[model samples]
Target: MKIKGLSTIRQKLMVFVVLLCGVLLGLVWLLNVWLLESFYTHKVHTDLQRTADAFSLLIQKYETLEDPSQPNGISPDFYSAVQQPEYTTMLLGKCIEIADANYNCLLGNHALSSGQCLLHPARTTLFGDTGLPSWNNKNVLAYRAQTLADGDMYFTLNGQNGMRQMVVCKNVADRYTVIVSTDLERIGQAGEVIGQQVPLIAAVLLAVSILGAYLFSKWFTKPITELSHAAREVAKGNYQVRVREPENADELGQLARDFNTMAAEVGRTSELQRDLIANVSHDLRTPLTLIKGYAETVRDLTGDDKQKRTDQLDVIVDETDRLSGLVNSVMELSKYSSGTMKMEPVRFDLAQLCDEVADRYRNVCEQNGYHLDVQTDQVCMVKADPDSMSRAIHNLLSNAIHHIGEDGYVALHVKPQADGSTRVEIIDHGAGISKEDLPYIFDKYYRSRADAGKVGTGLGLSITKAILISHGYAFGVDSELGKGSTFWFVAAAAEPEKSAEA
Candidate 1:
């Protein structure tokens, strides 16, 4: 089913803009989550490595103060390092023990009931058969690796708080090694601050994305909405609907210009159609009224002269014929306007067509005392509907003959132009049209001053113009006041062999 009113352009644009905003907001949410996770994870890992390095350095300094050959005890510097005010020692409040490689405590006792120190078990297990470090296993993360530079193992311990954590451990050395650690609560606190702000950051990003989408949509559719409103006004028959386009030659501005041009042309055509109907109605009614009156008079004559009756009958027949011709022209113009006129184009010598048209009007010109001149020096085989083209040529010729005054001459000229096209021109030495009326001479019922009192229904030139336009030929009239008028039409060069070659 077709959607009512959904086909309108504004609705489509609104939907597109809203959907675009939704998509952008969604992508912003996803990107924020990813960036937040990456930043926090990276910061946490760096803090952990730093904590482990610091503990390793402190232990190495303490080991330096102890004896190497005998069992080394806790150094004086180790006690001093523990007493440092700025340091955070997990070993301070927590009970711990110092142990040898054989799991025997060499320092003062802080052992458990299992005869193993709580810290000792953690240390032994970290380097023992499990092949994994157990730095207070449940509450910690640790790693024991043989150092690449010295081939000595180092044990590291870590704990996470919020999104960050720190690691601490002892590095294995040649003669002595010591254990140390630092609390990661500070780094973890900083990580927690960042994690807590994620939602707020994500909200800001979403808002920005939505705002950006809205602004872009507004920018892009500004001209489009103007065009839509203009189109609507045009639909209401306001052909003056015009958009103030930007002076720049952008696509949207150019589209507005084209639309404006189209609307103006439509307005012109509407006025022309109105004039055409009025003139046609007037021309048709006059001849029809004459014929009707003449026939009625013949019928009402009680004792008329036979010759007078015959003359009235003749006038009626002539007026009837004129009316029929006008009607036929109207029908032909309708066919052409409705795109129902069919032209059976064929290859024919255009020279022959012009000659035939000139000949048809020759006897009439001579009877009207107008000398007829035919000028042709070339033959053109053009692709066209011969009947239509011949009619066009005959129209100009007949018009010239009718306008030529006594002792005047009408000339029919046919020749090829430099542009590979053939032109047929009909010129008359008679009273011509006014400059003001020449522009509308091809319109139905149009009559020049030279055609005054002539029995023309005024449809021949119009029919000729329509026929020529439909054939895609060029036709026009040039007139000068008092001198004469010339009507000309051009036929394009095409297949000389046959018009049916297509």
Candidate 2:
């Protein structure tokens, strides 16, 4: 059978938590099982050594009590030595035997037999072939015999009554040797107790960890889930969908904020796309309708009258030209905006270029009863793409001409700044752009309400902006609701020597 793996983050997290808890608990169990016995054994050995030292000190005191002047007899206080807690605890439920140099029991808990020494026959037989000091001597305990013979305290392990025991031996002032013994089985029992409780404790901890992991995974993935749903809605073109922002200051929160920003931008772009289609359709239909209607009128009725024929044909030609200009402007804007237009900048006379661009509209201005004024105090040499710069100035002049009515004047001003830059301004005395519409004037296919009946595509200023921007020139417009507007741009001024020396 195939096993299904954890598919969700919650399942994965819970499993991870359980595994972590298990590993930690297993380590604790291993430590208890492996090292616990040795640690306990070492502790017991230390306690036995300290008890032997204390007993030796007591023996030394008792020996001092027997004055050398009357050395034939000794009076030892065995009662006080055995009463000590360290001595009592070390001897509890264990075999302890103190023997003198002649192997007679000097002081012990039990009474000696008729000829019995400190080492019982059975214990002596156990140590007989062990190569210890007691292998030949049957009186002293094996460990005590070794300490007396070498003057070095030591311990030994041996099996006694089906339990392991540690025997520690120390000599006391050459008068007596003390042997302390304890069963090591109690250390194993303590380990067993710990081993029994580990599973229960681990089970409790694992349960708590699993619950915590579930809640944590749910909380963590909540925002991501909401973002997923929002993205789906956006894919379905419902750009209004927005998720509640997460309160966290982490990467997830930042992702949510960025997602919202993307949605807002996409919504705006969709709205603009719809607006573009409607505007282009309207603009195209108007010119096409006029051209078709005028051509039919000329063919059906105006063909017989010379002035009528001329007027209708002129109207048809004008509409055709307008349509051609609209298509061309659309293509030109697309080229510039898509970065297909190349820029080749050179030093040129800004004032001269403005004069030439203004003069191109002189005939039309005079016919329309408008005056063209050019102002330049000196030659302002600037670095810019000459052809694109000329096109930008032409578009600005065209825009001004369209806005300025009969008897209104359009002025072109070129000024050189002290910072080695040139500023060119095109001013028109016409109904100015509103504050609301001013910001969007340079947006593609955007036209202000003041320009409702204008006879050109709304891409002139946008194309001009793109061209100037590609040249890295600064450009903007300033206008009030009723006061006339001025569109201006700045270009870096060429060095005086470059202009003069050339």
Candidate 3:
């Protein structure tokens, strides 16, 4: 068995769709993560601002009650006002010339030693050493809060275990620092869960896609499969195998149309072949019947009277010759049909060959009391097989003589063609062949039965046509019912100059 290559179309399509879907999903997920991060940052900032507002209120009350002569440490009221379920608060000095790296926390509910305000990557430029930077680096507010005396109270926040805190400071003189934070690690864990689920979803989708691909491939190749089987049936001489049409009218439809045409041609050719065989059988049997009857009569019933015996013998001889000619003609036609005829090139004189051919039929015409008309100049030279060329001319002359009635004339003529070739025509002034029979006159065993009395096996013109064709000459017939038929052939020049040597 021949091993064809495995199909790749399904694999290619699966890979393409899978890659496209994956890229699209990846882009959407990445966009979702970025948007969520942005929301998270915003939530953190808002929580920090809320804590700062409460701390500012408590600090204002403290300032109103404080004595300027001696500053008091942070009162408990400041931390209490900013306290939240998830936040811490601290009170730093309101009036102290804060050094480059200062830490003066006055009070705290729970504060780290680091006097730093809450900061992420975005805020790291305005607080002391051990302090997270202020929110905006280019602001005079951040600069004053970090460098000037009685600067902003600094708050540092740390997220509680499983919780987050936000730290907020109100202004440069406020002694309260508040921190607030929220749990954001839970969001990361949720994303991990989604990431783990993606491949499982892809696997499920791939399984469905594979099933779909298999079904589609089978469906696509189905028509071709049916066509192949139909062709096999047609080869078995069934012309009725029309393709069962599917809903699709694509290339397969055209193939079906072509297949039907091929089957039709095959069926028609087979019928013609059968008809030809029957015709050939009938054609041969008629002459055999005549010859056999004439032979048996001369042998047994007809007395040995010289004239009667001669006439009967002549009939038998003529019919026998006709049978031989018919058989030879059929053989030649079969050779032509089988493409076994060999073509040969040779040099010979055309006019001499025509003269010889005319002489033979002249005898026949004289014996039958008909005029033999020969017309041509001498030396019509051409390049053709002398034997086949003579046979072609002889067949034409014989046909004319055979058809010419008593006192009727048979004419043989040779002339030069425009293309350095010679044309020979044989004409008979007898009952002419019919128009309908003219086209198939050269067909094997085709005879014009308009005259039922006509003899011979009906392969005369067929053999003549084959002989001329093998020599690359052209031949055809022209006739009217009463005007007789002209059978003509043109022979190519035998290097007309070279004929001088011959």
Candidate 4:
């Protein structure tokens, strides 16, 4: 079953961290509870062996003593070494006995002061052996036999008083055997102490782990939460909402940067959408208003006058055509910008296309006292979508006409370059674009301050850009304020095929 609490990143992170800490602490607690006694026993055995070795070294140093009747049968130097802090601390509270090969006590601690010396049996027996009656305690006899057979042995023995003792025995220097014993009560005390303190340590560690997990979860999930809130704001059409960028070079930081970039693009598109709606509405309403008003005028007043009636009807027809053209332009721009328009490229004469487009504007140019110039000499065959390229050329020419006022001229030039490319340019002597506006001149719905009152949708140049780009043609505009503008596009020149031999 899916638990809601563990669904989020923060919750899951906290759960994982807590579980990890819990597993570590639980392992430590188990080791302390189950293995503490064995660990302590091993340590005690190691200490016993170390002490035995030190005692053996002292014995070797004093083995040549002239008189064996000295105090404790050891030299003053051996006594001094045993009384030193290193040996005294290791043997403290433990019974130590050093005996000769004949079982005669050479040196001993307080345990030997009772006149008891550890003796080795002539024939040793294993532990739990029923046939041998060697030492009074079978465990002591078994351990003694093991020490003799194995050179050193560690074991636990029960004294006659029923107290348990841990013992270690080792034969040293080929003459003396060193035996050390300690009460098993200290190990029991340590086990009890560990049992009491483990829970407390675990509780303290658990509390610290909980705090650390919470802080880490908060730090890890903070960016995701911010991104979620910003996404919600964007869903509500608030494109201005921005998330703070993280300074780290990790994935979350990169995600934050990407989110900010997407938000900025969304904001820009939203602004363009608003402008498109406003501009389209304005353009549509004007022609619509003109068509409605002119038709009503023809019906109300010019019905009887035939000449006046024709003129009013013509105004209505022109306004209707203008509205239709505007709608079609909007549709075409959308098609090109949305990448839905299919390009059908064929080898076509660029010079011929320019001539045809200029011929269509010949009457308008003459009527407005504007000169239309077409400069081309070569065939300049290029591979491009004929219909779309025609539209782009028409739009450029129309744009030039709109910008260049009465008495101004529009020039169309088709030139072939040495690199097997064709260049088509439409030049107009008009109020040129400013440096600040040149960069965004081809943006949708963009209008310069000078062209704000002009009659044309601002999508002409943008549509031209999209059309040329789809055909893989390089197109741009160069303009200087008050010096005219030149808009041009370049297309690859198609090679003419040679005639086949018969």
Please report the candidate that would top lDDT against the real structure: 4
Model 2, 1-502: lDDT tens digits are 3227987666776777778878988899888966899888888788777767777777776664332343322343445455667666655545555667644444443221222223433232210122334322553555555677777465555544444556667777666777765555666778889989988888888888888888888888888889999999999999999888778779999999999999987997787678678777888899899889988998899899999999989988888888888889989998888899888878788899888888888899888778888887678888788899999999999898888844588999999898989899999988889998887788877778776655556788989989988887899999986678899999886756534565
Specify the poorest-scoring 10-residue window by lDDT in model 4: 122-131
**lDDT of each residue in 1-502, candidate 3, tens digit only:** 3224534544554555556666766775675554556666566556545655555555566563223343333234533443443323222211111211222333222222233323322322112222323322233234334434453343434443433333444442433233232323355556666667767766776676667666766676677778889888987878777777655678778777778788876775675466567666666677678788878887887767778778988887887776776677778777855668665657777888888878776666667678888986766777777777777787788878778854588889988877788888998877788877787677655667564445455566777888887777878998888778899988877764534565
Worst 10 residues of 1 by lDDT: 140-149
Error of 1 at 258 (Å): 4.4
**lDDT per residue as tens, model 4, 408-462:** 8899999999998999999999989999778778888888878876677798998
lDDT of each: 0.63, 0.75, 0.61, 0.77
Indicate the residue-level lDDT of 384 in model 4.
83
| Per-residue lDDT of model 1, residues 1-502, tens digit only | 4546667554555555556666765565555544655665555445444544554566566655444543344465564565465444433322232333332333321212233223324433211222234322433222222222243332333423332122333344533223332222343354467666766765776577666656766777788888889889988989888988789899988998888888887886776677657666777778789888888888898227798788888888887787887778778767765669888998777887788777877777667666888887588768898887877787788788767745578898888888778888899877778887788788766665556455556778888888888888888888887788899988898654535665
- Give the lDDT ranking, best first: 4, 2, 1, 3
Q: TM-scores of all models?
A: 0.59, 0.59, 0.46, 0.58
TM-score, cand. 1: 0.59
Off by over 4 Å in 4: 1-3, 19-209, 235-238, 247-249, 349-382, 405-429, 472-474, 484-502
Please identify model 1 stretches exceeding 4 Å from their true place.
1-19, 35-259, 302-304, 402-409, 417-420, 429-458, 478-486, 496-502
